[model samples]
Target chain A: MHEDRQQFIQGVRDCLPTLLGYIGIGAAFGIVGASSNVSLLEIALLSLLVYAGSAQFIICALFVVHTPIPVIVATTFIVNLRHFLMGLAIAPAFSQYSMKQNVLLGTLLTDETFGVAASKLTKQTKLNASWMHGLNITAYLCWLLSSLAGAMLGQWIEEPTVFGLDFALPAMFVALLIIQLQQQAAGKLMHLLAVVGYTIIFMVVFSFVVPSHLAVLLSTMSAATIGVLTKR
Target chain B: MTISTTMLLIIIGCCLVTLIPRIAPFILLKKVSLPKWMTDWLSYIPICILTALIVQGMWTAEQGKLIISWHYMLALIPTVIAALWTRSLAVTVIVGVVAMALVRMFS
Candidate 1:
């Protein structure tokens, strides 16, 4: 129980950077939702249940245009389809964890949390359910509360990115990624470079041909396949 | 802000769509054992996905074309240094925020 407490604390600590980013973006989402004429209660519910930032943001835009409900639902599914891959990627690590634990973990898994946990896993750090909950619930709370506050703040700021908060997502990803590569790439630097280089090139080319989200999924899956094939 | 029936439906619908994709794999894989190659492939996914995100996040899409945001690219210099030097997620994030703020303020 004591170690569980420690793991929980560590998870919360690991999520601190994610917390800062969430506060700004969550509130910005709230402001956007409010300004878009969605009610505070609606925004709150969306944040609580839907919980995907991009999906919720798109929902607000669609609400204004009165896009057909079926269309919105389909778009939401497509926009978040990448999560299936994310869940598959992280599942093996949680194999020892119970179904209940995996359910909760899967529910709260976001790009940031996945990257942070994956980065830690690369360091051979041990993670328990409590840690996962601490990391997830803390981020979830920040998102919920901040968005509610932003909804109440009532849309005075036109663009929250003026404070450069939008950079957090990419920054967090890059930091996790750099650490992962540095830890694992020591022996085969060229192999690592090839994988990363392939990803960038594929993403750029795919973006030109497909939607950006689809581009990300295609590039990631294919590049990882390449990493597997070229493994020595 | 009164909640409308339509809005309620939208929220509910969005919730289902969002949750299904996120939770599907966990449910499907619960009783199955993964193959060795699958595990190896999954191991590479973290880096691949992260790289894909960073590449796309640095660019803005317009009129079916991608335009680079020099501000973000400029700010990445310090952030990457922070990551390599300290390898602390929190420190790198703080440095990134400050670096981006400076980039935005100056130009």
Candidate 2:
């Protein structure tokens, strides 16, 4: 097999766990979308185009409350601002690809993809464009299709939590964090601990005062700064 | 459910909001040179962001109060162990799902 083919296959293989988690969240999003007085087509389009799980959920909640259009748009933008950081984090690796390829990869860079790619790229020195495409495309399809299933069967699976599917996303994230933590340099552990500690405290104290999206952004920035300053 | 004009605009606005963040960095920063300090700081982005996301996932705010769910914390035990022991994302997720399901089933 060609090296690129092998890398692509490996990328798909690595995404299997994330796919399992996405299946549940995507369906939940679909169910919520269906119940929010939006057409199935609109729900599907949102998943296909917007493609951010938390942001989509927030949009649905605001939509149900009949939030003003500007508020909804602004909230979604703030919720998704983390993607800007994700994009910058991966920019160096993607510098090797063409503008068109970068566009495609950027569109597909969800939290799961960013998590998987960040760890994978850190371990390997070379940039595998096809491998990344494989990973992103697989995750993208899982999210889109599972969401479609949820929308189609929204009524039937009214309570997705009954089956413990709500835990899928958290579990997936925990797993990703563990992997990333294990890959960190020995001296970096202190920074990791500080970042985790600071973020928890920030979230607990400010979750009510600030919008959740802004809280997230603030916590992330602070944690990254803590890491940078503490790094030797 | 039927779509209204407002919903359509919100969707389009959402598309733009998400698209710009994802696409802009790749386009603008692709050829731009970043300082070593900036790159070192960027290295922390994933760990910091993921940590914050995990914390956010743990407890949700209800009526302006933080409600911590013991269930999520319990499930993380097995999930973290599986992640460390197996080092396999699939196995870790499966263990986590099964652990949570069992907890929900019995508790």
The pairs that clash in candidate 1 are: none
Expressed as tens digits, the lDDT of each residue in B1-107 for candidate 1 is 68899988888888888888887777767779778899889888888888988887778677778898899899999999998998877777778878988998999
- TM score of chain A per candidate: 0.92, 0.92
Stretches off by above 4 angstroms in model 1 are B61-64
Tens digit of per-residue lDDT, candidate 2, span A1-232: 4987998888888777689889988987888877776678888888888889988888988999989999999989999999999899987787887889888888888888899988876687556778888898899999999998989888676666667777777777788888888887788666687778887787777687777677777888887787788766
Model 2 residue B53 CA deviation in Å: 0.3
How accurately is candidate 1 docked according to DockQ? 0.67
Deviation from native of the Cα of residue A231 in model 1, angstroms: 1.2
Per-model clash counts, in order, read: 0, 0
What is candidate 1's lDDT per residue for A1-232, written digit by digit as tens?
Answer: 9998998999898888678768767887888888889989998998899998778888999989999988888888878887888888877667677888888888998888888788778766345778988898999988999889988876677666666666766777778888888877567767988999999999888887887778888999999999999999
User: How good is chain A of candidate 2, measured by TM-score?
Assistant: 0.92
CAPRI-style grade of the A/B interface in model 2: medium
Clashing pairs in 2: none
* RMSD of model 1 against the true structure: 2.2
